[model samples]
Target: MLRLGSPRRRINIGLIGMTFVLSIFAGRLIQMQGLDTKVYETAAANQRTQIEEIPAQRGSITDVNGHELAVTVEAREVAIDPSKVPAAVRQKIAAILGRQLGKSEQEMAAKLAKDRTRYQLLARDVDPVVATRLLQAGVPALSTKKTYRRLYPAGDLAGSLIGFVGDEGNGLGGMEQAKNTLLAGRDGKQRVETGRDGQQIPMTSSQRTEPVNGQDVRLTIDRDIQWAAQRSIAEQVRKSGAESGTVIVMDVQTAQVVAMANAPELNLNDWRRAPAASYVNKAAADVFEPGSTNKVITAAAALEAKAVTPDTVYQVPDNIRCADQVLRDAHAHKVESMTFRQAMAQSSNVATVMAAREIGSQRLHTMLKAFGFGSAPGGGVPGAEAGLLPDYKKWSGSQNCTVAYGQGVSVTALQMASVYQTIANGGVKIEPQIVAGTTDTSGRYVPAAAGKRTKVVSETTAKEIATMLESAVGVEGTGQLAAIPGYRVAGKTGTANRYDAELGRYEGYTASFVGFAPADQPRLVVLSVLQKPKNGHFGGQLAAPVFKDVMTFAIKSRKIPPTGSAAPQVRMRAGQ
Candidate 1:
């Protein structure tokens, strides 16, 4: 700057200055990538690499015999890349999308015409063939994402019990909803390094936390028995023109619910088309008047209080008054002398009411509570209800008499089935268990033991009740239709009209039969309930036949032997 220079020297000075500026820029890059390496390296890695979660697959649902009930399979969701399509081909694309995705052709065309943006999910669950056609047709907009869809191999067989999944592949109903946490998978993720071009570099400081898949759930349900029960109940519902129906079968000893099914079932594969009512598991959720079924509980209370016995004679009248309530038999009867057992065998409401009176209301109420009425079965199934049981202190006098005969009290089918199971299991009231096992994330199996035992009635008392029940299958018994020839049958028939809230006075009826076969040593306890049958209102007529078919299959299928000698004969009907 102090010396004057020739023109060539000045030009060379300018050129040297420009070269020095370029060198400074290159040195700054070195500082960032080398000298100040940590700072820029952290910035670059943060900008280029991102941690993402990878979801593990959920476990399968199987039956007691390891038959797959519900399983998840990988599927795909397809979207359209509208921005890549030409305006000239928009209508063709729209028609193609309409045929594939079930979208309105005109609406899709309009949307394509107005938008150049990439379209996502213009279609989903596309058939592979359709996708191939799209590719062949050179439809520019289509993309796909791998996803999962739940498939029920058994379909409507155990849909209500196993439940169905939502569109998002999450559990929505039944066991699916109840054990979602144990049955659902969790995605895990970690940091990973990437190249400057946004490409992942294998084995380069990747932080990976593996995902844990959900546990496989095994239930006590028998697929064969479940299907049989569902078919039998559905056929009966259709034939009898009943509003609905439920059938339940439980192992007498294990309290394992072998089969529980309801009519009007929904196909799990197409659950969206099923009615909401079909989605409910009537066996666990619906509560109804026990009708004559309550009489058994009344008898239990009487026996417990030493108020009566099978031989104890009671002056059974056509009607009896306890407080202001007049108890009348469903059938006409005189003030004839009848033994307690005969009364039970005949299903006499007056006799049970008198016995309940002797036991007193408070004691009867307590026994009912202990028998698991007024409470949920704690079966661990979802949508289980604790049924209605009015406290004795709050009961009207009529409530006592009506409750004695199963009129005022409410109970679910599962609850009612368990009560009989307790009697069948010699007074041990075991909790009903459905799930058998569940596989953990590590592939280890966890056993389910919800059938914990607790004693309610004495064995001697249980045997007496069992004997009294057997008499119902006798010729004089109202439930003679329930008798399976060659095999002893012990069961009670219940017929109660549904009290209409709009127009009182017992509008419709629910007929039900709860019984055990080979009465000497009960193997299975089957309960079948029919709601509002158009053919007949009697349980023996409407539900007993279904029960017989179910029990017969159960007996033959289970290979249970006849109780006694002389080859007990099953009476052949006149049909064939």
Candidate 2:
């Protein structure tokens, strides 16, 4: 304020003020370096470090014979940094990528025009060889990431069973959906310091967690047998002009499902192209009336209740009144007295109803439940249906008689196969198994738990019923087409009228045949069903030959020796 000095003194004062400003700046720098050093270091590390995920390797799915059904193959994803491409070369780059990736030049150019986007996907699931070619093209902005794509080497052979995965690498159907958790392993993370170019910096601190590969899943399905079943069913369905078909082959002793095939199947490698209905597993999902094939249940119930023997005589006619309903034999016949065995071999509806009437409602219902009907197979099969079975208490007078001849009751093809499996297994019901088990990291197989077993009928009654079935497949009976040369076959044919909901009445039929070969010592139970056949509607005419073809292949493929004995003869006439 009292500045009465020269200009040099004023300059000295200005210099002192400048020194104070410099001292304040030095104090601030010291505080930042010492007191707030951790804050700045954290910000710097965050800017230069990144956490990346490492995908786990998915496991393979194989048949019982070790044939690869589904596998994960190495693939690549091609991406580009739009901002990294120079404007002068952008057009040329887009053209080159368009040609390599099978895309239009305009589309590639539009993607490259987004300069603000650092990363843009050019192609996904590119074959490794093709990705290598694109990488070698010397495009600076282009980059590739390692990935995996699922492949089905067997194509649509077991597509419905093996199932497919979604774009996000998750299971979408069949065993894929059922065993997703076991097949998809946990992913890992890695923290890495990066450079300005987004490359891993050398000698930088890092942390990593290793990924665990998924466990392999092995199924009980046999490749050759499955193919045989599929081919046979497809040929039969198409040749017969049927809507669809299902074939199931089960091991008689172990109840292991060797082959489950459906016709008009979708290709697993391209499931999206197929119709939605093709996704269903009809063998386990759909249900149909057993028709004459259910006659076996009536016989078993009668035999179990000690109401009749295999040779018990009954006077059956062309038609008989059962409560308020009239049940008729498949063919026109005169009134004749026939033994229960002869009646069964002839598939006589009147005879079966007469036998069931002796067993009554309670015992018949018990036998049906014991045969694994009215309940799901319950081996963890997805979409398994517990077919319709009204309680005995809910049975009307006609319902009992109609159910006796397989009119009112319904069952899945698998359940029907299991019913015969119980008979083939000496009246012991064993649950069917599809998945054998998962494989360990060391490639060791761990078998699945044994299936549940329960006794449904005495061994003697089962053999007696088996003998009756063999007679049905004999030259004199209705199922003569089911007999195999050199091996006595035991089975029954069924032709059930399919109800038309729109018309509210029966319009079409489901022709089916379930049988086991080498009648003396049953080994395999094969069941085939065709829906709405235009060529032939009888199970013996349409479904039996398919069953025979599949069974012949199964017998030879399994190396099952013949019984070396003729089928047991049963008298078809009143007096033989």
Candidate 3:
């Protein structure tokens, strides 16, 4: 204490230390405000600017008459800014939102408790009106985003045909999946400047890329006909206790699909509840033997090749032998002398086999290919299968005879209907079509390109088959149940042994009826199919009634009057 320094020296030392500290701070300020100025400015801009994605509206699906099947409606996504919400009031606000949005209070509270997060989703796909009412509560940090949600207005009317969308708004099945690209438009983007509170800064620079909305798809389906077909098939499937069923109706002249219906169909609005198999359009997807319905092809091949005529006599017994197997008719009968027309009208398997032999294996195979078998039917339908048709060269000895009677070969309901449509169209086969066209950006309707056309047989051969089909619907024929009063009808019934893949054997029968109305001037073709029927397994008994109900409504709905021409007389028996 006695040897202290002078006052001037102490004062000078303190000033020097103060000057050093001030110089260090000055240098740091120069570096930050001048040398790294651009860096700091960029960081500030990044904090204020925000980018957002804008979802595009999905397109609509409509029937031929402008009925909505699938549509998009305005919706909102409710969210919260957890970081901005006060901890004391978080639970209260969450409870209010939970009640209004149908969410659990605890879940909403947990989302609100994420204090570090700026955004937390409360609910997606909320109704706009509900969202508006939710905001009227004036809860702090609550927000709503504009969005769109899919709606199936017709319920399950065309559920499987129209299909459903996923959570991300992508098509999942049916026409929705087949034409997804055209239906799902491109999304857009937007960039805007915001303030510290996360609110957009007014009058600030903003950037946006406009979204391209999806185009509307129009189908050839008639709503009324589709309803009738679906109702009738569903009822028949239940009454017959079958595993499944299908019905298809087409315009003979245009080859346009008027109605496609399946039992146990998917409900578009609630598709998750349905089984996966029900999601398929079975009419165009399922494959099975056509049984007697396929005899028309043999008849066509024989008539076209001049192998046999309608009056050709056959001494048919109840059964015939081929290779190691013996085939029999539907019912046991003694050897009978019948003309070709009578054999057809009676659904004689033996007679069909004899005619197939006249045409030979190669000629019959050629005729099958010409009729659109063993090929995928492209009609803008999803899961359209190319039915199985083994080459004649690959046919086993038994298969040759079996294929002649529609055993070894397989075909879809649509393919079989197309065959009848070809006959009804005077022998010209047109590719079946479901989609009529799509609307342009300007909202103008544009028709699709015409389907491919091929001449399958001569007009004369078609007329001969038509007459033969008419005999099958006559009073004495197996398909008499399919006849309509005052209308000339032509049809064939099918009852085939159903091959059960799961059981690894033939367990039941596939009953089907394919036919056309106004036989003199065909206008419509209808096909009905029932698989694994427990109550009954005859096509004429099980499937024909469904065809009759659907066909009667179709003719009446289309206002198709009878041709009023008398049916031509034909020889049923050889000596008649």
Per-residue CA lDDT of candidate 2, range 359-413, in tens?
7889999999989889999876667899989898999888888888788888999
What residue runs in model 1 are displaced by over 4 Å at the alpha carbon? Answer: 1-53, 98-116, 126-137, 188-208, 499-506, 565-576
Query: How far in Å is the alpha carbon of 5 misplaced in model 2?
Result: 10
Evaluated against the true structure, the overall lDDT of model 3 is 0.91
lDDT scores in order: 0.81, 0.88, 0.91
Per-residue lDDT over 252-339 for candidate 1, one digit per residue giving the tens place of the 0 to 100 score = 9888888988998778888898888888888999888988877778888888778887788877788887776666887886677888
Q: For every model in order, what is the number of clashing pairs?
A: 5, 0, 0
Report how far residue 126 has shifted in candidate 2, in Å: 1.6
Off by over 4 Å in 3: 1-32, 82-95, 104-118
Ranking by lDDT: 3, 2, 1
Clash pairs (backbone) in predicted model 1: 81-141, 485-570, 486-568, 486-569, 486-570
**Which regions in candidate 2 have their CA more than 4 angstroms from the true location?**
1-28, 86-91, 102-107, 500-505
| Prediction 2 global C-alpha lDDT | 0.88
